[model samples]
Target: MTSAEASAELRFDPPGPGSYKQDPVHFPRAATRYWAETHPPAFARGTADFASTYGMLLGGLQTAYVNGIAYIVTLPAPEEEVPQRFQRAEEAMTGKLWREQLREWDEICKPESIARHRELQSIDPDALSDEELAGYLTRCRDHHSAMITQHMRFTASAVVPTGDFLAHVGDWTDLPPAELLGLMRGASPVSAGASAELERLIAALRQDTSAQALLASDDDPGDVLAALRDLDGDAGAAVSDYLDLVGNRLLDGFDICEPTALEMPDALLRAIRTAVDASDEADDVDARVAEVRDKVPAEHREQFDELLGEARLLYRLRDERGVFSDIWASGIMRRAALGAGRRLAAAGRIHEPEHIVDATLDEMCALLAGAASPSADELAARAAYRATHTAKDAPPTLGPPPPPPPDDSKLPPMVARLMRATGMALGALFGSSEAEHEEHLLRGLAASPGVYEGTARLVSGPAEFGRIVKGDVLVTVSTTEAFNILLPLLGGIVTDSGGLLSHSAIVAREYGIPGVVGTREGTTRIADGARVRVDGAAGEVTVLA
Candidate 1:
């Protein structure tokens, strides 16, 4: 069925009695039954954890899926907890609370999460018996849920300080968020796809003539990668180590339906090549920091320094939370599901193994246990529907219009400060201030500060990433932090969705590339391979050709 027909057939009712907004940033495409079941509760619980820890007025965010598209609503805290929340907010403004949370993330939360993911990743799902595989699926589902919650629990700690800096810094200078955010260039090494494994591999390749020759060979990309992984030396060991670290991680998106890095061998190989050949260049970060600092008034300059430092300290957590959490766990889940699908396909139970991803967890378990209630055709149809529908097919809002935000003016000063900081940060984090532009110009949020002209490569998903040559501008609906692994191929980034603080924007800034995000019609209006000029400082994309 067509997307419009599919939209008409599906119900758009609110899961509960509140306004629900579409979360296109995360779920721009339809979610599978597996993801629909696992993500909502985990998201709600995680948001609650962040809210309770930060003493926010809201209880948490609740999620609902309509026609497979994700929607979210915010819940309010109970009246009785107002006094306690005020006290917590006052303490939060002192910045001591988030600092402790940051320390916890670094010392405890991060290590435990990594350990759990490693344990799960080590298990070979294909080696398990039927019953053992069923149990393993359950375990993977549970772990994926926990990681989602873990990702959410740190949301406040990750964004609040950065938001606090933006809120305070905006008051002292007229610099746009794009310029101010440049100070965060070196803060998140992971956002630029930096890992110790990748560094070691690069070093090994640089020193080994044979490995470098193999990498430069005109052989099949997959065979090339396999040979590199099997090479008998430090270069080969480094290649294996790097693949073990990221091979199973999703190339884009959080859902299990998304393809992992190893699944896209050509793109992954190209990324490795880009990383190996990349030259280190000096960034004007220190100069930009000094310029922005001079704009801050004399008395608040010291406070400005403190806020900037805090923001930079916690900045890595924003992407790291998702990267180390559900992104890795979700890929593991996908691997198990695909393994099950392979068995089912071999038994002639399903038309294709990938169709298993569309099955609900219960259905997946039942199919594994030899129960055939859901026919293979049904799963195929579901997969087809999910693949065809995009976020544009769904309504932007479901149920009644949302209630206005509470007036912070009547609240205590500290409480108001807390609310403002959090609100401003999140608003800028996901919001775009683009206005309608002329036919040739696509307006958007000035995500990164630079100018570049290049061929626009319109990529709808990770599958098309192989078409991207180095220096091509990437035009997409949106990007997750996972896409940072491929940022080396792009000279600029233009997305149809996301704002200044979106992952596309963050990675572009960290990688020192031009980025114009939230250009509502970039992919549709700017033809693929069209020559385009991206003015990231002015937030405009001119279709030069």
Candidate 2:
């Protein structure tokens, strides 16, 4: 009431449709990030993908994930300066309470969290011995797992199929029959039959890029399909099986399928060798890309990216542009899609592999719109119509979050301990979904970068917060209203559970310290006083032994 005091800002609940207070599984950020799904990121652009290897392999995984869909009419277009707008709105509405809580959390959890981040980042991945590398990788994997396991929003954001995939679902049918087939092929599921079929087709791809490339260049993708159809009887069936396997996975891309660990998968290494062989025969890669580029329609030329994307999709599982990432995952998406489609056809349920990946939700409804299972050709037509005409769903708007949970000053000791543990535990285990057996940890992009060396105190639950040292890194999973008091004495922050916009990040920034938010398993993997370095810019942390 005094003139010296600033009037607290008013927080207004925005209108229309929005996501839950926060997603329970992924993307725990306060700001809305639905647009990040499926679409190319505004911040991280890349060269045009020429190989259907990974690019077109995209839409295969996007179609089935509903959570990636956002109601766009509610917010600014993706290209706008939305982050600043959100920050301002957030501050104004809650009297800057969220940021204020961030400051409070910073004062509570910073010191120790920051110390651990710096110590780990100082060590590099290359310098580690085999044992150290294994240990570090385990920590990384654990970091990823914790985020997925504890924070609902964190779990959703890191692994959701993506936004681009969601928008392009209706467009999958607009391409030529063969490219449609490739899309379906990429979406198929993996199976014993599909694997045998894939080997044969890949052998052909390894030997005959010229044959298919020639057809693609001439703008007659279906010609390539017809050629493929003429393969020796056994070989033809194998290819068909491969295409069907991919189709199934594409339709349900949101489902997680972690592959068993392998030093180098033969299927992928073969692709790289094939590319090298093709390029060696008189530098043909560029010429081939140009040939296909020229065939794209003048009016619809920009859409050529879809073709390139498909090419990249095939390559992503293996090549990764040139040098392979040691962390590359297995599982053949395109081949799997093809395999799934064949299975459906074998059961006499669908017509072909292409029909599934390219099947629009509307067309699927229309297919089922029939009293019984409709003919394959009829369903394909409806799908084609929807592909050319349907507009993608829009993103949901992000309004200001509700007022801060409560002040830290008045918190009881038990409540504060619980909140600290919740945040720390969630942060400690970020990525653990992809591996099999003892490979339980994962690595992820560290959003809030900082460094602080400290003794790591792993707290699996709330009861351990009482043992936190003033200079120690508080390792825990989730953070809530109660944990606010612990912030001031901490050196740095490491959470396995949240994103850049998560509570951990906000607090770290407020305290003017380094914060590696969304590490997932930071508490479990990084031991007490295990030196580490976290580079937010690089999205990695170096765990020093």
Candidate 3:
């Protein structure tokens, strides 16, 4: 089908109340393209299957768009009457088995996946036979698909208990959303690892004046990495070790458009700077957390405590599952492409190694099988064409937008809790918000509280991440948990999509930075490098100069 026809076809209208709209970043082009062509049958095996959920179905539609096929999805309408099955699931959601499953997934399944990814990355694709390479790619794709399913389940399950608690407590007090969720701050393995690694690097850098000075200098990240590598002591070893821990993670969501952490040294350098320069200015969140917990009403205090405990327990899993799921899987896919692309580039089949992402899995397999591969020029042309087409504006929906969220007061208690739970699941799926506004000041959800003024560095995509410097106000579409590595560098953050539960919001609160999220078009409306004021308390970003 023609590009226009495909784009038009992709504008699917949801048939029911539980539907949501997702940003293109959620399902990146490279990964989506491969999935559409290679795993067509798996897209909708069954609603009852582990892989097929309302959220994943939406994501699958998004995948079709990236593949240049605009197929829309209509989810099966949920039973109007709450079912016994849902109650059973909800009861199990916060039980011992549920918690154990999450813990098992994190402690066992996640690390095993990471190890497998690293092993795959180390393979010499050139030495493999045609069948072996194909088998390897299949394994990577299958593991990635299964991981995505697991991620959705864990995330959705967590959302139920957390959201139900929040819904129950909404009118009980005037507590801010950030404080309620603050218990999740700095708890994820991703943030903890990044913080700890940075601390180690800081300790080493402090003792080496030469290395510290070089790091503080306005040198390019590549140059900085090179200079650090040349250092013959502890500073070099520290930098090397930090990268070893974080370098393999994906820069964004499952989208192939984003780069891995290893490719963006400048962002990494900025993170290091934040760690070294941190002062007493960091938020005393633990102390404040105690204060918030103490504020529970005498009547509902026990329930409040239990709810908070559940939310905190579940919150950490969100980022942990993300690390093991799409983020890690994307890196593996990137490695597979890069590995094959390198061999192809050496053999003069593709113009560059990165161009491998542009080819379909079948095309890649053909190239590996010693069959005719697309010429370098042909692949380059296809890349350019796809880039332009993908850049064309995507219609948010095929028909009327989903109905607005129901008024909170109108919902039944159980239904209200489920609605809140659904919102969390939707947030995990789309990462965009329904917030609307106008003018020079962009309004969004108040993610973190504070005020700051700095030059706006709009990272429209991962490619522009290098432009960000310490203390700059970061404007972007949205960020993922993987971005925690660089969160400390920004004085504030503004995102075009995602709500308070978003990666940008959660990390901003953790790091005590001002942040406004879900400003639908913040990246487009705010000019890059312009001075701006971020009033995270008021949920607005205003251009100052």
Candidate 4:
């Protein structure tokens, strides 16, 4: 989230109501929402409710990346009957009657709202007081019952890259250095179509499902190559350029597009703005806190430090991380979205990938539709909504971090059963039965097309940083925000996780380096030092030695 000042200044200033004559901005038509449908009333999906998605729709021109693949629990819903009114948020909670303990405040500070207080204080942080906490929790639980509806269907999604689908132009470096520097220097409009040819190439990928069909087909290599040869200029060029792009971005961290900004919903813009401002406030507080200490006794400083260390960690602005907040948060998000979209397209990905910015699953698709692209009014109108109501979009409070377990003698069987059951249930749902695929060298879904023979090194974490030598093909799990660490040393990349928009894929395209991803088990299946052939357009990896 932290970056250079150049990132914000390059944005296309938001024009008044209407200005551009190019094609209308596109937004997604179709929308997909993902929520866990559970059978047991006690089951909690945790933060899984916030998993993200991206896509677009425009009449018949549509694209989607819906719910990612995830484990599902398929047990039947309770047989008991329930009334429709109870289904809403409030009714279910009324059934449970709060006992006298629910009214108590002696523990810590009681949460303000009755429901919130019960929800949080119901748990004993220290297992040592399980009996006391359990008694109190039981009392609080009575005044609150959960709403459970029958499960009609259930599915979960993992955020796969859609390779390039969610990356920024700066991410893949699709735009050449001169243009990039121009935008960085405010010498060029963000919309400066520096490489119009690339736009066409990416457009072809958005329109062509033929690549998917061809790759999925049982046809021989001869047929595949023949079909590719017979394609139109755009398709053929897309194939070649896509392959080359992926290879370079993955290997070199170059982008195929100049930094461009996209539109952001008003709500998310405000949230980011608030977050940034709050961060700055936090920095100010920390500095003043020391000043406060200088006037205090030394003995109190140690106590103050300990207390502060244990205090809640809130938003802070220790650094100028979110520089956009002071000036144009909305513009920053828009540009970031545009940047993401540019790279995604370069990686041969479709959908309004720019929609990934602050989009819910439903809004995610809308951002992709040719007709659905938000107007500047819509994107900036969040300020309007706030004038009407105080809708809260911040994440729901995390009830509480678990309190430490006490000595064994204070433990109770009921507490142990609950804790162990929770772990077991979660493990059973998410655990994979497939054997771990092991390989030192793994091939990934190609983004840029190329064939290179290089040293292979597996990077599992920052600790493995030293192993990466120049020109080495770095292979590992999904290329995420952290991949930037290896950028200076890697020549190419291979990954077990992510599609084209993935960090690994886009970075490869930016660098014009070769990359392959979404291999699922590339890390476990490929061994180090193995010669490999990466076909980015076809998403294929062949082991040579």
Best-performing candidate as measured by lDDT: 1
Evaluate model 4: give its TM-score: 0.25
lDDT of 2 by residue, 330-408 (tens): 1122222233345445656677754543432222333332323456776466334323320111122234543343343
Candidate 4 residue lDDT tens string, 1-545: 21123223323322222121110001001111111111112122212221110100000111111111111222211224112211411221222111111222213212222234334333333332323433433332222212111000011111111111111222333432112211111111111111233455446645667744554455654455346435776767755542222111111111111111111112112221222222111113345345544644565557445423321110011001111111112222223334434543454443444323323323323333333444434433422322222101111111232234333244343223222322332222222123232343333344555566676676544335545556677777544322332353456677665444344554555445566665656665567776665655445566667
Q: C-alpha displacement of 139 in model 3, angstroms?
A: 3.6
TM-score: which is higher, 2 or 3? 3
lDDT tens digits by residue: candidate 3, 1-545: 66556556654444333434434544423233564553334333421332122122112222234334233343443444235434544445335334665677768877787677667666766677668877887677676666666565565544555665565555466675645665556555454334456677888888998888898788778898778867878888888776766676787656554578878877777777777777745556578666766776778777777776776666667677777666777677777777788888888888888887777777887887776657678778666655545422455544455555556466444444555665654553345456566577788777878899999998756777778888899998777877777777789999876767777777787777788887777887899899999988888888887
Candidate RMSDs in order: 1.2, 28.2, 4.9, 27.5
- Arrange candidates by lDDT, highest first: which order? 1, 3, 2, 4
lDDT value, residue 109 of candidate 2: 26
lDDT of each: 0.89, 0.34, 0.65, 0.32
Q: What is the lDDT of residue 206 in candidate 3?
A: 82
Error of 2 at 39 (Å): 21
- lDDT value, candidate 4, whole model: 0.32
Query: Total clashes, candidate 3?
Result: 4
- Name the weakest run of 10 consecutive residues (lDDT summed) in model 3: 54-63
